[model samples]
Target: MIQHGLPTIDQAWTAQQLERNLSRVLNTGVCNKVLDALKSPNADFQVIAEMLKGDPYVATRVVGIANMVRRRDGVAIQSIQRAVQVLGLRQVSNLMLSVMLTGPLLSAEGQLPRRKDLWRWVIACGVANNYIASQLGQQTDDNPDHLVGGLILGLGAIVLWAGLGQAYHRVLGARLRPMSLNRREMMDLNVIHTQVSLWTLEAMGCPDVMGEGLRALLAGGRDETYLRYRCVEVLGARIAGLDASDASAWLADGLPRLGIDQKHVENDLGVLRSELRQIGKIFEVDLGSWESQQAFHQKIMVESGQALASLIIDHLTMQESLGISES
Candidate 1:
């Protein structure tokens, strides 16, 4: 509607559509059963593992996590039961819930490029958030649940994209031009991804604390419990290839409020980046490749208003507009 031929939907209609989609996904055959099991305090691991074995895609991911845990020892876990044993009951439950929530997007044909990037971003943020939580000595009895909350914080955007389909595709395509996704959503839909994310989390019956943490992050207020975690998410987005200028603003504003010294920011970020790279390997996602880093560096120069940067920006923009390539 604003530009680039993307269709605009009424905000009310978009919300309605998203709710319908979430209901359908949540109430479907195996998914409903899986979600019910995950929410149950007395969920049987053997039953859940058997159910996961039926879904090859979900099973592979479960096995991937197990192997990642044992990667240094070069141990390969083949059976779903064995993988479940390796990951523990709580982790298995969290993984099942995560997979169920993401199943729709992953199953959407012709959206793999975007889906893969979104998955990588979410996982990196989760790992980074965990690192920050550890630094602050915020240990939880259920660490996987805490990590899952961080992983799914950005999921609202993906949920909206899947719910809106071609309408969202147009929005993504427009991202190749001048506008960012948040700005475009604001202009076209009169709402932002964070709002959608909170709605989606609530609809999925996630813990209230998870939604509270996300709300705190978006509001930029200093909640004693969520501030440090939110700062890590901002840093994680930068590490996952968000705009450097945006990250700079987050640091300039949010760091001071969180009582973080400006001098310590760079060293802390370095450690986080190193940790993310290692985590990326375990998760089978490259946090940022050399070429992507170069691209981002050049993009930052353009963002800084360098006179000669326009040509490079235009070239990159054209490539993005014309191709369904990974950023």
Candidate 2:
């Protein structure tokens, strides 16, 4: 069993045991078949990819890959065949298998709060991540994996939302977000989801380097991984076009934990906003649509609150038990 800050588990919540059970499930033959299909020949890519997409676990990965390949390769590609060519057979297979294995990480009995806003943020983050990758020259115009790191960045929150049921709602309502809350409050709200999601991803066969890099990025440290850099890039973009002081304040107070300096952050924010405008033009969406953007930010706050509430409850139980033992 894994030991969190809480006291030893009463024989039921060991990390080792959870890891063993999850590992076995992930290694099963059916899971392997799903992964194999993700790597199938182009003639079979669309059918299999679509089938995989039907599973919630695989949907983001499929979409991420398709987007990466199309954007980087610039091959005027419209199908999965082009995606595979852009991303290559190996990377696609790894992502597909990884997606299938992540299925069991979220418990089945929990109910999530608002999902629409969370999904929109996830998609936005993914888009922002890809744009950063493009700017960094990590991929050409056709590859989709460029944003793979960003799409699943919030998996930890999703896992918590899936695990805590209603306890999450009550606690998040009581604490964590009260208006103009600090970044520490957000972290306090989300730390459990962050840890559990990372552990779950590790157990599901993600390369430790990638998983750890992402964890570090979210946890806010000055790490040097590609994922970390990209996270900073996306975050900077999220608040771009706002007052420079406001954006800088977010960096000064909240984002430094992710290891980016304010100067670089401001610079990246400019680049990303410009790039986003271009992307918006391509998609025919108005990047500077003030009313819509305000609505979107409001929605993100509402949903992020729910996600935070779920995470807080999971950790609070641990904290509560520890407190009782200490008292």
For all predicted structures, in order, the TM-scores are 0.66, 0.50
Summarize candidate 2's per-residue lDDT along 1-327 as a digit string, tens digits.
222243322223323434443343333454455665654464365555444433322333343345533443433333333444455555676556445433333222433454322333333455566654554556735444544555456455444443443543433343222112223324434344445546656655566755754667556554456445444434633533222344355546544454445466556654444443332222221123323453354344334323322332232321132111111
Measured on C-alpha atoms, candidate 2 has an lDDT of 0.42
What's the lDDT for candidate 1? 0.56
* Model 1: residues with Cα > 4 Å off, grouped in runs: 1-28, 38-41, 69-74, 109-119, 140-142, 169-181, 218-220, 256-327
For all candidates in order, the CA lDDT equals 0.56, 0.42
Residue 99, candidate 2: C-alpha displacement in angstroms:
5.0
- Candidate 2 deviant stretches above 4 angstroms: 1-31, 36-68, 71-83, 94-112, 170-191, 215-220, 223-248, 252-327
lDDT of 2 at 190: 34
Best by TM-score: 1
- Residue 197 lDDT, candidate 2, scale 0-100: 48
What's the C-alpha lDDT at position 261 in model 2?
A: 54
Residue 199 lDDT (model 1): 70
- Candidate 2 residue 166 Cα shift, in angstroms, is 2.4
